[model samples]
Target: MPVGEWDAVLVGGGVMSATLAVLLAEVRPDWRIAVLERLDDAGQESSAGWNNAGTGHAGLCEFNYTPQRPDGTVDPAGAVRVAEQFAASLVFWGRLVERGVLGPPEAFVRSVPHVGLGQGTDGVAYLRARFEALRGHPLFADLEFSDDPGVLASWLPLVLAGRTDGEPVAATRAAQGTDVDYGVLTRRLLAALRERGGEVRLRTEVTSLRRRDGRWELAVRDRASGGRRRLRARWVFVGAGGGTLPLLQSARVPEVRRYGGFPISGRFLRTERPELVAAHRAKAYGSAAPGAPPISVPHLDLRVVDGRESLLFGPFAAFSPRFLTRGRRSDLARSVRLGNLPVLLASARDNRSLIAHLVRQVTAPPSTRMAALRRFVPTARDEDWTLVAAGQRVQVLKETGGRGTLVGFGTEVVTSAGGSLAGLLGASPGASTAVAAMLDVLAACFPAQADEWRPRLAGLVPPPTPEEVARARRVLGLAPVRPAVAP
Candidate 1:
């Protein structure tokens, strides 16, 4: 058996690992890095253009980030933080483009208006308040709101067409929002890594992980030949999406005991009709469904992949025992252990509404599903749109207060004691915030080098300083979002 050694072994070829590889290459070029993917190709799961909505999640349109306060005020802190992270990502991508590491921006990311929509008095009021709260923030400077039906028709003709106006509806638009092909971006990043002398192995799985002689050892199996090999790395990263938790557990990591994952599959209604696709060039995000979690928020988006335009809507949920889109059926039940059982059971008990929503979605009749699309596109035809499978997202369940609880909708970084190992958990705003997330991993996993790495990191990504943020907005051609003024 051949034994390979490296400075790092990144499990998974999705955006997270690819992004980390890019950053590491620029920061520590001499250190060898290898990315091992179980799938035959990179980004086959979560990061695929077809699998994700591809919104450049800068908090411009997502309502989940801003919550209403007691005084009826919308707190924009969460949104601001998310926006900041996205800004860093923009900076990273922009620099990569300039360096010829990535191809044309239009290939992977394109400017697409992002809008938040709501109807009824309660919903309208929330949208109105949210707009007011975010109006002058640096990150939301160019945000605009309109309650006029005539104006809405111009912005979202499909949504307003063939519908009579009764209850007032409102929307907020940010023309600087984007639709990104994370899969393409992932491939480009991997290309950049290879250009810099890094390695990526597809159709290769990391079968097991163990600590041996103060180093991490991974058992690798080639799907083609069924040949097994061993490899060692000074540091290891589990960015395998839903596959991360189980792999961490297999390594006997103590931190993995507190974490479990539940698979959530999404299906989208996609239309390639030129007319429909042309009518909507923006990503319109609506409020979460009744009794639904933030992750279940419905969105209607215009996606451009490989230069082809299309519209996608409705992330209808379904039940899948597999952790990944291609994982084994026994994945869900096999993940259970005494340490994580309480958390898993408690999460199941607490997330009854979520489970119920999934059940309703799976059992929904054709008419029922059509009605959903009608909410976003009043004149949507059953023939114009076809149901298509999106990606599988696994939400992380963590033990909190001795009970398992679903983590919030954003991403979380988990590092083992001594920082020898690290993994990313949770869903939503993931790929869009990969650079910022990887920065956190770098800081947590390599504290000794963080200070020295900070200056170099700034060159690779958007900085946190106000001046740098302003510069990033300019570099990325973003809507003016300077920072909100006190209302």
Candidate 2:
């Protein structure tokens, strides 16, 4: 083999890249690796805790993960997969904390109850079915559900405020859920990787990628020093969050053909009242109203940052020309490649519902948003909360049968058959399941090394199987069966 510049080059400094770098370093300690980040520091983008809901998306409180069919049947597959992935991440993060790689575990992750709240008879039925379907899953053994208003009140009293004195409601909760500060985790993991002699080049941007003699040649620019450089790597991973699409197009990999991104920006309402904040102790998620987009499903989350308990709600999705919140205005226009035109067209044709939802969102005034908020907290006063910009999520769009098709959720990993380059596309149930997602990337990109890497991964992720779920329940002291149906 002719001398390659490095063993691997990671394209971003977010959770995905940092996690991959750590995995590669642990397995191939002698290999040279470099991380190129466009920003001045790591974890400043969507992975930042403040930029996201930080729910640790376990399918625990998120009802959108388990949608009901037209025939009234519910599929628990999506919920189970998300729950299993989050379980694996907790085990992995725990091991890293034990190894001193992530110092002061509280800085990055904290345990908090996850609750799902809903109203009326129809909503109660959905919650009951969702609860039943998930209660038996090995990964969801700790779930609890109740229809009593008293039980619902205990979970979140404000949810029932100013309601008809006899109105009925329902709630389901799980103690195993968490709120993860992914940015903090990213910084800590990257610190350990650096300690192991791995190089992370901040403020370095990749201008282009080309295959030269079966190796990846990346043209890089040092953002701070105005210096240009070239790096040749045996493999390249593009973990650029929303920037991945553009980079993949530059590679002309063909696997990314007919793909386009639809940008959705989220906003939240936060309360500063200490008294109200103290009353709220868990993340309470609710079902989206009829015809509401899945991304617009409202939730009231209790967020603890820097040891302060603050309440956050909403994540109302709006249209944006920029792929990232900090991205350039040219993002949407520049990503339209010849190969992706069909995908773009197909997406618009298939997602009339999402388009209508976006229209209502954009044309609606601030008062409209306040009205939506009132559904979750009837007593919630507009004067008590302020609107805060959440983050930008670039949903994936692709061509299907000569038309563009829009997918609201699920993540796609696109890499050429050669496995020299790969990029992650889409969002949702993100950040919370970084470990499993990265593991899938490694499994796809490196098949031959998987058997050897499995043990190392298992040590970090505990048991990634049903059998381990039992052991985890015992060791973690979690309930074995939905915790006696909550009151």
Candidate 3:
């Protein structure tokens, strides 16, 4: 059993836990912090480069963020919020790089243009409205939109090749976009935490957590040795990705009683062919199908992982009983309880479209998936691409306004027990906004110290003003955002 209690204990070795660990270490250098991971190393789960799209999800290209309103206008609020959050992440990482905590930025993050494509007359009109809505914001001032085939071909040659349907298409491009290898970044952050006297225990699974005598007592098991031990901490953060819900339930947290988790796994079609990869230098996203979940929004991305570049497309949704990819097959069955049964049932009743969408995707054949990819890249050859399993995403289900709602890819921070324990739920725009999300956790969990910590936190992660955004981009080796041209 581990003896002295820790000031903070962060569960999960993904980017979320790594970011919070580093932030706590920076803000309170005297506090003892520890990170626990079931995996042999950090970021092997959702944070891994191959498990996710690797986009710096700044709302630059993802169309789902800017939904069209009933008035035939596009709402830019969500897009701006995501853009701001991503900018905060850039500032945090940029500062860390300058302090020599992280190595060269290009090793983990690289410049990749972001584009939003809209096909057909209605699609093009909606995209034009979206462009007009976001082009005036300081964050999106450099956004460019055009319906001309020549401009789109110049932007996405691979998508334009072999296309002859003559369907009208338009796209919006943001030059200052990025692709990040979060697995590398997570490892780097954890390494920095260790250098600052923080402890990281790998291959240690936290089996359960109990609140006793004003502190958290955790029972952890050693995967390799079959040894069990007990550890204590003043504060506990469950950033376990899909594994978060079960841990919170085990702790008997009343706040989680009404919550349920719906596990959705994904598959991506990837091609390492140099010619195809060379033709697509951007992460190009399109709208989701009518009955699909937000995670089904199709995108063709140029992914840079471990200094190698490849093109990936189609996050074809697959049904999974396990919350985490490596989790137990009975995880879903075990999670159901009398408390959340109603929530789960109601969610099912309310989200039949999403459920049906998952059914179709799970049964979809390889030929169908390839055909879906051809929507983005008309010239994509089946021989050049292979299907690879992506990370499992556990969408949150909870009652909102007297109805059970199945939340999409947006993330939520849930705190309980007078803020002593906190957990992160939901997915998408996850790692890219981790710094900001952790900052929120800090503020919520430690309201007393927030005022004092504000100055220090600000210094570490300043607000993303135009100047700060440019500075971070410069330090991160991303291209400068050119001024927006008149639409």
Candidate 4:
């Protein structure tokens, strides 16, 4: 066995790990850092472009962020926070582009229309209220609302082409929204890290984690050489996606207690027809159907990758014990830890909503899915779109409300005192907001150094200030927009 030491060791090659690596390399260049990926390449899991919806996730089109209250009012705080995170991400990507770390903007990111659609009077009222609430925000300045048939047709003719007009409905459209190729961005960030003297080891898996003499020791297996090695680091980050839980458990960390992940497999429908694809130039999202879970919201999007124009719809959730589609089925059972048992029990008790979701998805047939798709595109042909398997998402579960609670959305950061070892858990707005999430990791663990690191972090992503927000609001024509639901 060979032994080596580094300043830090990151145990995942997805966006979260890659983003952390970039930030660490930028702030602490002298510190030796190494990345160990179990696969042959990076970003092949959740960060893969094809594995998840490509929306920038500013909360503009996702209704789940603005849940309605019994009093008819809605909360805008969650949406605003999500929007700010996305803004931070945009600034980070902008800096990465200027530094020549990423490819051309068109290769990984491009401006696309984002529309929120709804039907019937209740949906219309909700859409109208949501539009009013967000119109004044800088990030949401491009939003436009309409209930007129012609206006709806102009934004998405496919959905309105031949539908009955008597049904009360409306939509909000934002032209500034974008589609991102997270996989490409991850690769580019990895490249940048390497260029700045960081080490990225592919085909290497961290088989074990242990602490010795106040330092974290990682046992790594080199697939190509069939050799085992040990590496020591001042700090260890478990960003291993579905593999994150088991690895953290091996460290005997208290935070991994009672924490369990519910794996949700997703599938998308893709189209090859250029004319049908070109006609649909925007990303259209809608509220989940009755009795459907929030994550099951249907969306029709225009996906452009490597100079190709195509359409995609539905991240219809499926059941799988495997964390990643490409991962082993034993991942779930192996990750159960004694500490997390309480958390798991609590999660299951609290997530009655998600239990209903699991039942609905597990029993749904293909025809039912197609019928759901027809709601978004009345003219969609069953033959035009084929079901494509996407990445698996491990929804975080823990103790909440004296029982097992399952969290369908939101990201969790698990860190101990002084942040010696940290791991990110949960789902929703995953890659779209990696910059802000990693920044949180830094602030929590390295508070003193952040003052010095702040300037560099700013260079990578300009922190959202009141002035920037006000200016962006004005520029996006949000000055006239008013909040229908008061905060």
Candidate 5:
């Protein structure tokens, strides 16, 4: 029996679902909206502050976003697109703060410089090329670059400390970059949704989803009460992070027939030592090792969670058959279907280097992990940091040109059932791009409402102009932007 019907049902309590719920409420206030989460509380998974690096990924510090071309020039297109997307998120959040929908901006977001570090001769050259390529863009006009050790010392004292090697080094700094506590933001979005008459059901897991009579029927179970019920919705969105793949498979979505998932877990070295945290005031990203996945790019971040500061480093790969931290060990095996088996096998065959990289990371001892960290922080001590498990990211694998291809760090949104059903897959630059990604979902799934909703959506998340970006930064308590130094 169907207990309730809704205009939209979002299957997750993370940032993505919460964002979509809030957006829908703003656009179609008369439509009933509901969000279902399996966890006891919201934002406990990948959106959690501790589970991620907490960098507001605007393509500022992450070197992987800008790869070198054959001619030695850097590609700035990917980074520019990411910067624009993150600007939308900032604008939406700033509007919420201005309207009293969210509390103080400082509670969830803070200004933190983003720095891209490049070591060795080749690294230095690439860093300079990247800076030159991006400096002309409005979003990165304030970027600063330097190869002098003295200037670098002032910018990154902790990273420069105790470094005796004279190897060439370079860095680029963007002051507009920020560190965001997405978990706090997610919870706040959900809270605002409730205030707008949206329903949020926690501790309730959707067992399955089926299409019936122009609506999606979701079989839900109350984890605490052992009771089950059915609900109906005109549209259903699966934003369950790593758990999304299985749910889409269960729905028998044709778009997912040629898709598979490869689970990749990560561990970080975190420290709450006040001195160390204070010394490193920026999120610094370094290039990934040869033959490693882009997600393997090493980064050191200054994280502020719940008004407390700390430092995090080394997202060393960890192996787990489970798709999610709380998911079953059988998740990987259960997701392998006849339609996706070939894709999975091909992905594994083609990504042997990635598999080997994971193997090295999983079996590497403490000293090995420490050595990796020392590359970023020359004086880092093992005693000051402890290994902590990060979230599980399910990399999406799909058949492209008759061969399996592993999607990189970018997020992928899959829509099916004539745009009535949709799910989010992949990770990295995930939460930072929530607003833009959710907007795409709305456009893709609600084509009939596109023209009607265009005006309302525009008001909510307008195209980011230079003035709008400046205003959003000011509203978010960020400092004014500075002009870029001439190359």
Candidate 6:
């Protein structure tokens, strides 16, 4: 077989590409690999710690993962699957630590409690059900739930402070939940991959992709020098966050030809106030406004970026034309094409409430956001928090049955059936599930080498044997649950 120009070329320096690059480095160390990033550096866009909530997203506190049914029954399948997938990521990170590929674990992940909290009759019922649904799962063995004010006060004093009303309130906690700085983690993984001799090209943008003799020829340009070049690779991956859709479209990949993006910009009320920040420790998640997207569910998160702890609340969703934080303002318009016109128009007609929620979020004054924050921190002072722009998330829209469908609230890996190209789209449960997501890409694209690669992957994210799962839990600082011995 003729050796291709390069073994693999990965676009985007964010979590997805970094993750796949690291995995491929371990699986195919001898293959030539390159990671090209459009930004001046990696981790500046959606991967930035401040740009996201930084929640580990293990379904520990994100109630949206477990939805209630029409008959008042709650489904735990989504929550359980998410927890299992996130555990795979923990296992991968733990192996990296044991192998000394990464520095101190705290540099990227920090243990913070994950709490699901609610008030009133409906809120209390939901929390109780959500807590019960997850209690039996080994992954959530350390979970706890309560309705007592004293119990809640200890777990979350800020939310309960100065509230004397006998209004019913309920909460659940998983002590081992984490806050992960994807920005830091992304840079760390890339560094390790670099140390292993993988090449990383920064400030280089891929303008187009063309297929030539079963390989991909990427048209690249150096943003600073205004120089253009072409790079050839056996395989190409578009993991450029919101930019993935356009690049996939440019590639003319039939798999992603009709896909479009609906850009959602998130803003948070952030506070570094010692008093306010110190009062909250857990990431508190609450229900979303009726008809709002699940990703917009309210949450007050404890974020640790660059070792400084702060609080972030209320992702007041708004509309934006740009797919990325630094992308051109005309990005949304550029994405509109004949292929996705009907689907785009259909989504508009079907999701009126979602569109309305976004509009209300944008028009709502600062005071309205402050009011939303007050739901989590009853005594939160407006003076204590500052409204700050977070990041851009472009949710994927696809045409199915000749109508547009909102695919999901999490990431989707789009790949060619033949396995030469792959792109990731959607948002939520994003970086926290990078390991599992990349594993999917590998399984899809590397079918030829999969039999050989499986054992290597198993070494890292081993089968969930009793001992194996416990080991991964221990690495995350979670207490290992011992199987009960017959008395």
Provide C-alpha RMSD values for all models, in order. 2.3, 2.6, 1.2, 3.7, 1.2, 2.5
Q: Give the alpha-carbon lDDT of every model.
A: 0.86, 0.81, 0.92, 0.80, 0.91, 0.85
lDDT tens digits by residue: candidate 2, 21-59: 887888778888888898888998898877888888989
Q: What does candidate 3's lDDT look like per residue over 386-487, in tens digits?
A: 999999999989999878898786889999999999999989778999998999999899999988888888888988888988898889888998888795
When sorted by lDDT, best at the front, the candidate numbers are 3, 5, 1, 6, 2, 4
Kindly give the stretch of ten consecutive residues in candidate 6 with the minimal lDDT sum: 478-487
Candidate 5's residue-wise lDDT over 289-381, tens digit each? 998999889999998988788898979999898988898999999999999999999988888988899989989999998999999998999
Q: What value of lDDT does candidate 1 attain over all alpha carbons?
A: 0.86
TM-score of each: 0.96, 0.94, 0.98, 0.93, 0.98, 0.96
Question: In candidate 6, residue 342 scores what lDDT?
Answer: 76
Clashing pairs in 6: none
lDDT preference between candidates 1 and 3, better one: 3
Q: Which stretches of candidate 1 lie over 4 Å from their true place?
A: 1-3, 464-487
Task: Please state the error at residue 194 of candidate 6 in Å.
Answer: 1.1
Error of 3 at 196 (Å): 0.9
lDDT for predicted candidate 6 compared with the true structure: 0.85
Residue-wise C-alpha lDDT for candidate 4, range 168-210, written one tens digit per residue: 7789887767788888888888988999999999989898899
Per-model clash counts, in order, read 9, 7, 0, 12, 0, 0
Query: Lowest-scoring 10 consecutive residues by lDDT in candidate 2?
Result: 478-487
How many residue pairs of model 3 clash at the backbone?
A: 0
Q: Which run of 10 residues does model 3 get worst, by summed lDDT?
A: 1-10
Candidate 1 lDDT by residue in tens digits, 1-487: 1349899899999999999998888889899899999998898899999988999998889999999899888999889989888878888887787787887667788789999998789888999999988886777876888888888999898888887758778888888788999999999899899999999999999988999998899999999899999999999999999898888889888987868888988899999999998889799999988888887788999998878999999888888988899998998998888988878888888879888988898899878878988888888889988999888888889877766578758788888858989999888778899998998999899999987887778788856565665565455555445332333
Q: TM-score for model 4? A: 0.93
